[model samples]
Target chain A: MTTRERTDVRRLPEKQVRDVAVLHAILDGALQAAVGFQVDGQPFVLPMACAREGDDLLLHGSTGSRLMRTLAAGAPVCVSVTHLDGLVYARSAFESSMRYRSATILGTAVLVPDDEKLHALEVLTEHLLPGRWAELRAPRAKELAATSVLRVALEEWSVKVSDGFPDDPDEDLDEPVWAGVVPMRVSYDDPVDAPDLAPDRPVPPHVRALLDRS
Target chain B: MTTRERTDVRRLPEKQVRDVAVLHAILDGALQAAVGFQVDGQPFVLPMACAREGDDLLLHGSTGSRLMRTLAAGAPVCVSVTHLDGLVYARSAFESSMRYRSATILGTAVLVPDDEKLHALEVLTEHLLPGRWAELRAPRAKELAATSVLRVALEEWSVKVSDGFPDDPDEDLDEPVWAGVVPMRVSYDDPVDAPDLAPDRPVPPHVRALLDRS
Candidate 1:
């Protein structure tokens, strides 16, 4: 949160939203986030699975990875989560755009100490997979050693949403062409059991619930 | 492609792929990409609609924006496109991961000249909207003036794909617990016409084709 002024959306100011709930909503809805960080003035962005817990965004990766080690050591980072909701079909190619909700956070991360690491993992698992966490076995000590859990606070952030119709000029709107939004969404297919799973084992309810909601 | 060595995937070398076809497939399947660029020592990653034209990744935005102006002027950039195919369920949390195909291209962008701007726009439109570009009206001169088109070559890049089942150890595999991948995909619902459109006008074929594919 060092440079607070940089978080403002200068391109399309009207799309900029100042609501914390909107930020949290976008983060909660997204499964992964693109994290940007610089090393020796060169920027690197990698996609990582993420979950939101309270006012923080939880990220986990192999402790051996350079990104995890650098971020865990409190390097400045930019985390962004975007959802492309739909495509806006305008009468003119210039006015065409996409409907999307995005949230970007600017700050460093705090490593989850060894004592609280398990709880943090639990929070992440439950948020992403929901009821399946309780059904799964506990993580072994060796498994925990190889992973690093870090949390970035939602202190300095900006959320921008473009969900409405395209703002075409009055002249363009009168054209005989058809124009509207083509809605898009994430859908889940049937669960594919592992080849190693016993044939008698049935798909869990929590997993089925995901498809139902979809 | 300034530091050529930096393009190597040092973290997960096993997942790193050197095939150009894989990179093209990943970029073609994705709708947007997270572009990272450094200003001073601060890093920023923003999601932008992207299209792949030959060996170049085409990007367009308002010429007035700081990012567009900076990237258009040949600033170093790292563009990443990731498609999360499914969630991998493993016996232990340590071995779990997502099935994804990601391509990272590192280079500076070259601005498309005024003469080629319209062609670049057409390429982008056709890639995203498919057959709709032929039906849409041509871009006016004013609209072209307000936009900036830039293309980044896929010269120094890396493709990483993790599409297999979880790589759990032999001991963990013996457990009777079920584990597998829950497939995920982007689906489209029925397209809704604009409220301002003529009530009798029917939906276009190209837009409907998208839903059919989904």
Candidate 2:
């Protein structure tokens, strides 16, 4: 999806903005994100396992979570996703930096309607477990009542990014220092089976497929 | 180093403040984070590639970035680090959720003094590239002058985390749905050598060692 077109005086310059494409990449690649907000002048950030549902982000919390209650009051919020691409080492300390992609969305969240909540949940499930949704049982009424689901539109956002090698001072370029980017990434390692699983139960096909891909 | 004493918050009872030890784990393990602040009246949250530098967080930007300039103005700022620990697949769609750990710090920043800037740079260097700082050239006067370094104390912060599997409704627990956590992590693959490097130049010991540790 495209980022918001509007610009503000405080916005990062075009070059920095262009780097924002990395932000989208981080969000699109992950299964979850951390959502931030200000409550009573105090800041609160919660890491919610999330899924991008269509043009909106679907987040679920316990029914009585303070974050959920705050959003229910229509408070403005910020959702951010970031992926650390690499560490840039320059000839000099001033030029050392990181290559990263991050996206921040600033907007108010609305509770998902009863009818749409199920779909959002499905999207979240698939995003996390891939094939588990079809195999799992659906939520009952009481369970639905105990959960709080939020849908935030991905408008009014900006992405800022930095990449490439360090930009050393001209004079120090010849300094006998090694310089380059050391990359980093998020990965899924071997899975640990649940302690309570039945002895004869084999790894499910979906889980096996995901592990194999990794 | 420990997270600030007053900045830790607990997830149980859902709102009490905890200790820094708990907060430290969240900050240390988060996969990504969004750094937020205001320039003039507009809000900006840039996802940061970060690592803890003692009790302070080391954030790097362009030599003359808007973010650095604004932060140098002494306005209050918020930095958040988050990791999506797992996806909580419950019996029902509404019960589906994610487990995560996140830390948020809110405070004013001080432009690190010139005398201490070098030390700050070392903290960042070691955090990002480990042993590369000794291998790289130090910053020259002009290069150091051109860069901005700001330090925000970890006071007035809070970390909220959730782990384990989804808490499905009692009635739905019997519903033949699969439930569990799909764990996540940050990993590194094989390193790619720079094309400009002399063909005979071997990978440095420090760089090569990161593969085993990172």
Candidate 3:
């Protein structure tokens, strides 16, 4: 079901994704998002760490931020998550492009209730760093007091998935250059321990696990 | 040299970068950028392939797009480029964050002139996938007519670099958990040939170079 007025795909209708699962996957796979809001006639976009909890996307910013305050008051915002998948090299300059999955949500956001602030923070922490939430110390009261958490319902959104090969026109196919997708993958390097760590402390199992998996 | 009003780094002042070289490097290294503009008080952020040509950042969109049309008329916009460097695991949830290099440029954008549209496209192609612009067929007249290229001057911008280890509070540092940065690197996989390629055609040297370098 698409919110036809707000979430309808206009430019590339073929790449539009309406499945709820696909939208969730793109959000879950990304560690960060670009959040945009306008002040007067100018728009400001900030790259922020984000997390999706069930149907609402959670984002945190300094309590003193004007943008955060504007968003907390239910201003319309757009949160966009993009995963760059590959580089598509076609036989023509016009056809060459990138492979990416991008989801854009357009809606007004409300501030998270004070009672759920800690839980929201936990959701954000766990979603971003997986197992680190349980191992790390809980947020202090002052820390929680200084942060603002906002949630935008996933009601009006559009997901565009472009994972296919380059679509060169029939005549351009024989242009005498190789054409294909060069897949881009992100690999995690070994963790570098903090310089201030105790001499006896070693890289923990959680950090080591990323090395093995990535 | 700092345009404090527009480019001030508000959240974490210490991480703010004012060097033009670092800003250029971040833009040069990125293949895409999230461009944000507002229409009727609602902000829209779209992912588009980007190229930095000297002091102007070039982005192309369909001529029929409302955003593109507004931008072509010199609407104020925010173009943000972010490179996610790693995940920072700290001793406390409050201290955990991501390491990234982010540059945000705030300015009005002008449409590239008709005469220079092709050159701008060439700049984008060469910056995105080097060594292939000379090998590919140039865009046809109809294709050029359908594309809209906009350039934003890099006059007022700020770069934020967060590359340091987790800065956990002193008391939390002994929390019995490993803390460090898990670096994320993007690498290219072996090229997947297009399905319709001629049997005798091979992956070109330009495409093979990415495999060797990445």
Candidate 4:
């Protein structure tokens, strides 16, 4: 069983969701996460492509990066992923807010062992760009050596969901204004071929599939 | 003149951009930022709506929140904003990456005085939901009291932009595979009217404009 610590929602306790499925949904849907770690009391947040494999989230970066090195050393870190669904418009500024699903995990990341490094990379590539892992050339030994894969177990995490419509006060609801949601989404456009593409090479079926799915 | 320290890019130095204008552009275009701050060695990253006013970036949160209180106390913080432009696919898994423009700022945040708190809130509202600030009712005294606005000067920061096409090695480039970028964007759909909206109240002109702009 998964146990959580100080992951409770203090500000908006009503919005805190404790279901594990909800946590997985947030993790699987997001393409990237903002990783938070500190160096000499100064915190740094970097954007990274994230992949959720079973109980742990996989994050990869250049082994030479200070943040990666710190994480490999088991420094405390926070992995946060947020999806902005829309802008909530209300009659009053106080009630106006955003509709988002955000999940934050607090833990130390352990570097994936050398024996499993290639498998971790496969998980990341498949998660970030589905079906491309099978099409692309696998990472060579040198490439794996240059990359650092950190996996943080999903032991302590919190998921907050704000998916409701604007909730303005009764008095404000009577105001002659439109108060609702402006839904937003991220979409993929047509893929552009590389400049030095070999002749007779067409966009791969997997790439074309992405457009269809989008 | 702005002085920067410890903002140098250590890994992949070619992607680092030191131009202040580029920093401003990244800050101005983003609707939200991931705020990183450490408390007792456990780091937390929260999603925050950001507004760039002059040389300072304003962030607001509940006054009762610990993160807000810590930041108000002038604790070191890192505010990062990233815009994902596209997904880069290469012939090899090692060469594949995402196209993104990310900016990270390191500094201490000061609480905006009570007198200036309202203006700071307005800046945040306008930046996040452009043109909606003027239409909504201004915050009441109680609401203003419950909110805490903090400003961090952009004196030390760095930006990393990855806009180039896939840079696969010669051997991989000749592989009979498609390698290019699939453009991505966040856009808004039609506004969904609230169920309890006043009868015959039309969507505001400002809200309607969002769809067109997107």
Among all candidates shown, the one with the greatest DockQ: 4
Q: Give the better candidate number (2 or 3) by lDDT.
A: 3
User: For model 2, what is the error of residue B129's alpha carbon versus the real structure, in angstroms, after optimal superposition?
Assistant: 0.9
Over the stretch B1-214, how does candidate 1's per-residue lDDT look in tens digits?
3455777887678999998999999989877899888787677889887899999999877889878987887888889898888878777766777888888888888889999999999988887778878888889999999988889999989889988886777788766566888988999988878778755567888888999999
**TM-score, cand. 4 vs. native:** 0.97
User: Taking the tens digit of each residue's C-alpha lDDT, what string does model 4 give over B107-153?
Assistant: 99999999999899999898878888887777899999998888999
Question: For model 2, which pairs clash?
Answer: A20-A159, A23-A102, A138-B92, A139-B92
TM-score of chain A of each: 0.97, 0.87, 0.95, 0.96
lDDT of 3 by residue, A100-159 (tens): 999999999899989999999999988878778887777889999998888989988999
lDDT (tens digit, per residue) of candidate 4 on A19-126 = 989999999988789999988888889988889999899998989988898899989999999999999988877788899999999999999999999999999998
- The better candidate by TM-score, 1 or 2, is 1
Better of 1 and 3 by lDDT: 3
Name the weakest run of 10 consecutive residues (lDDT summed) in model 3 chain B: B1-10
lDDT of each: 0.85, 0.64, 0.87, 0.87
What local lDDT does model 4 show for residue A126? 87
Q: List the residue pairs that clash in candidate 1.
A: none
* Model 4 bad stretches (over 4 Å): A1-5, B1-5
- What's each prediction's TM-score? 0.96, 0.82, 0.96, 0.97
For all candidates, the clash counts are: 0, 4, 0, 0
Model 4 scores what on Cα lDDT?
A: 0.87
Interface RMSD of candidate 2, in Å, is 3.3
Error of 3 at B97 (Å): 0.8
